[model samples]
Target: MNTKKEKPLHSLFAGATAGAIEAFVTYPTEFVKTRSQFEGKRESPIAIIKDTLKTKGVKGLYSGCTALMAGNSLKAGVRFVSYDHFKGMLADSQGKVSTPRSLLAGLGAGMMEAIFAVTPSETIKTKLIDDAKRPNPQYRGLIHGSVQIVKQEGLKGIYRGLFPVMMRQGANSAVRFTTYVTLKQAIQTRMRTGQNMPTSVTFGIGAVAGLVTVYTTMPLDVIKTRMQSLTARQQYRNSFHCTYRIFTEEGILRFWTGTTPRLVRLMLSGGIVFTVYENIIAVIGARSPDK
Candidate 1:
């Protein structure tokens, strides 16, 4: 058994590679998810997909993919690197991670990604996604949109929902990593075969963890979406104001908007992400002489 811990730098590279792949593969579902979340409108994922296809062709589904891919690369890299580093720091004398430690590590990782990557990337991506659906679109493409936001609203414009983004990502990732680690550990314990857990098992666990994270953090996500989608000048003020308006105007169920598309994207993407991250780490570890 290889006992050497993964280096944070290696985790960062591996995570960025995995994230870039996940973004492209899952961008369509993500577009649908964001569409439904905009303004708390409840639209069927199927209907959104069909309308997007008819209005903009297949490429429409990838409207904000460039921003998403860019953001996800840094977000996922930061998340994995931070989680690995934190987990190593909190590991027991025997180098085993406890449940509480895993959760804490995930919290730290999520906060880091939220602050550095998710806020800006998501803001830009959401604007692009919404623009594609508008009759009079302001921005032409990723570069154009980013430039417009900066020219009009300055750098702060790109970080519209910093608070809710932090909350959503912090809770979402904490639940995801903790649940994934717990489930994976349970599977290993059940097998007790002294053999490596199959890649399929890893994927399965990740999918389940994704489901858990989505439902648990749906409210925060909805609020984050609403806040981020505000105009460059800042319409909603802050996360609290946005959350209050969402509930008072749209009711409690509004917070669950886009649940379907989000679940679909996360389940598949989460499975792919964890499986790829683990496999890459394993390969790297195997090649190292210390391992």
Candidate 2:
């Protein structure tokens, strides 16, 4: 067996690289998801895509991609780095990572990401995405938008839906890492081989993990997206208020606004990111000092 140990920095790099890749590949779906959340309507994913294309063309599908890519890079990096660090610290007496501990580690990682990376990036990206119809958008770019947010609403505005974001992310990590570990172990056991696990297997497991995360935490995602995507003049004050209004005015079904696009995006992203992450960890471990 390969004896090298994983390093924190490895997780950071792996997560960032994987996140960037996922962002590029699945950004169109993400754009559609954000738009659906903003619309607060029961529109099909195809209808959203057609409308976006008719209105803004191909470029519209990738709007705010720069910020998204950059943000995802940092977001994934911090998440995986923190997760590995915490998981290593919480390893059992036999140096094994139990499923429960893995879940806890994932929660820690997600919360850390929500605080450090997700809030700001999501705020900026959603602002840009929702401003598709405006001729003169208040936020010209990511950096400018960030500055204007602080100038107009202060630091609190930068993190408008922190709680829901945390919830969504927490659920994302808890389910993703735990499921990934379980699936990987299962596959390894089934293979009955001493060689390294295949990249394809890791990717498939990651996709399944992503699907679980989305289904389990979609309500929180809907709430978070609505809270973040509101225009300056919109009425929703906060997460709870937004949820209340959505349920009372729009109906409960509205909360699943972008479920379709979200599922597709998260599935690809989850699989791609985790697969890359695991492979990178292996590489890093092979070269680590402890090895």
Candidate 3:
């Protein structure tokens, strides 16, 4: 087993690489998920895809890919670096992290990423998607859209849905990390493989973690998307108000509006991200003189 401590830069690079790969591969699913949430009336994923392709062509399915790709890279970098930093601090003298400590570290990482990377990127992506649906699209591209949003609504516009984003991300990381680590450890112990499990094993574990995260955090995800939307100010006064409106007007099940597409995206995302990140980190460690 490699015992070398992972440098922050390595984690950042590995995470960023993993995130970008995951985002690009699963962007169409993300597009469908967002569109599903955008509508007041529920639409199946099949219907959404057909409509988008019919009206806007194949490129429409990647409407916000650039913003998400960039954001996911930055967000994943920050999240992994922060998680490692916090985990190191909370590790016992033997360098073992308990589940509770792991959860805390994940929470910290999630909150940090939400504020520094997720909120702004997600706001931009959501807004772009919203604008694209308009008959007369207001924003031409990512840079122009970002500029227009800031110009019209100021910094607050770019940071819309900060509260729900933080909540959703925090819970997501806490659950994902803890679950992944626990399952990995259990499988390692059973297999006596130590920390050098096969890539397939890592991917499977990560998929399970993503599955858990999607269900647990779906409601928060919906609220965050809604809050960051173009019509949020007119539709919802705040996070609580948004939740109330979703529940009262749209019904309780509405909170999971995009569950199918989101689930598919995240499952593939988890598998791809963890597999890529772990492999990169391993390669980095092997190249280190100290290893």
Candidate 4:
């Protein structure tokens, strides 16, 4: 096995590359997911997808591919890099706090990732989704929208709702990486009979972990979506203040409004993500003669 320092950056690089490819495949569903989170209505995420498609046709669903490709690649790169770095850091932390230590590592990894990349990408992505569905669309297309955001709002507009974004992404990634690591370790233990634990087990664990992360931190996710969808001026007036106000005023249940659809979405999305990610990694490992 390659030591932390010695291991190729293939996992991180490949993970990001895979994520970008995957993002395009499911970008339409993702647009629906963001809108559902923001609208905070009791409607299902699928309903949101259907409605958008009906109103705007298939063209409407893929409103923000540019934002997604840029943000998601950065997000994926940061996440993979952080997960690897944190994993290395925790390797020396000790036994009693092993899992907890790993969780913390994952948390730190995710937090930094949210700060630098994921949050901003989420903001741009959300705005484009809303913009496409808005009465008077601000952006004609992804590139045009991006350029306008940069021109009118400056780079910050591109990163409108970074706070709750951090919270949502940080929480999501923490659960994902930690769960993946834990499941990998557990499966390794069961590998004694020359029979490995089924890939289903790992994928299932990842899906459950994803659902937990998404639902637990859902309120923040909602806030992030709403904040991002706002215009730059509207966003600047009071994003954090509004987040708190929404929580207090909307009833806590409001935060969980679209949670069921989100759960289903995450399970399917995350399952595909992990399956593709692991297979890619395995292929990379196989080609390495030293392995």
Best by lDDT: 3
Model 2 stretches with alpha carbons more than 4 Å out: 1-5, 39-41, 232-234, 284-291
State how far residue 175 of model 1 sits from its true place (Å). Answer: 0.5
In order, the Cα lDDT scores of the candidates are 0.84, 0.80, 0.89, 0.68
Candidate 1, residue 41: CA error in Å? 4.6
Superposition error at 63 for model 3 (Å): 0.4
What tens-digit string does per-residue lDDT give for candidate 3 at 110-132? 99999999999999999999888
lDDT of 4 by residue, 154-246 (tens): 988877776677677777877776676676666666576445456687568767777777777777767777777755455436667766666
Error of 3 at 35 (Å): 0.8
RMSD of 3: 2.4
Better of 3 and 4 by TM-score: 3
Which structure is stronger by TM-score: 1 or 4?
1
Tens-digit lDDT track of model 2 for 34-151? 8778754466778978987897799878888888898899999999888877887788766788788889989999999999998888877887887764666666777877788788
Q: How big is the positional error of residue 146 in model 4, measured in Å on the Cα after superposition?
A: 1.0
Give the clashing residue pairs of candidate 2, or none.
Answer: none
Top candidate (TM-score): 3
- Model 3, 189: alpha-carbon shift in Å? 0.6
**lDDT score, residue 39, model 2?**
52
Worst 10-residue lDDT window, candidate 3: 282-291
Candidate 2 weakest lDDT stretch, 10 residues = 282-291
Q: What is the lDDT of candidate 4?
A: 0.68
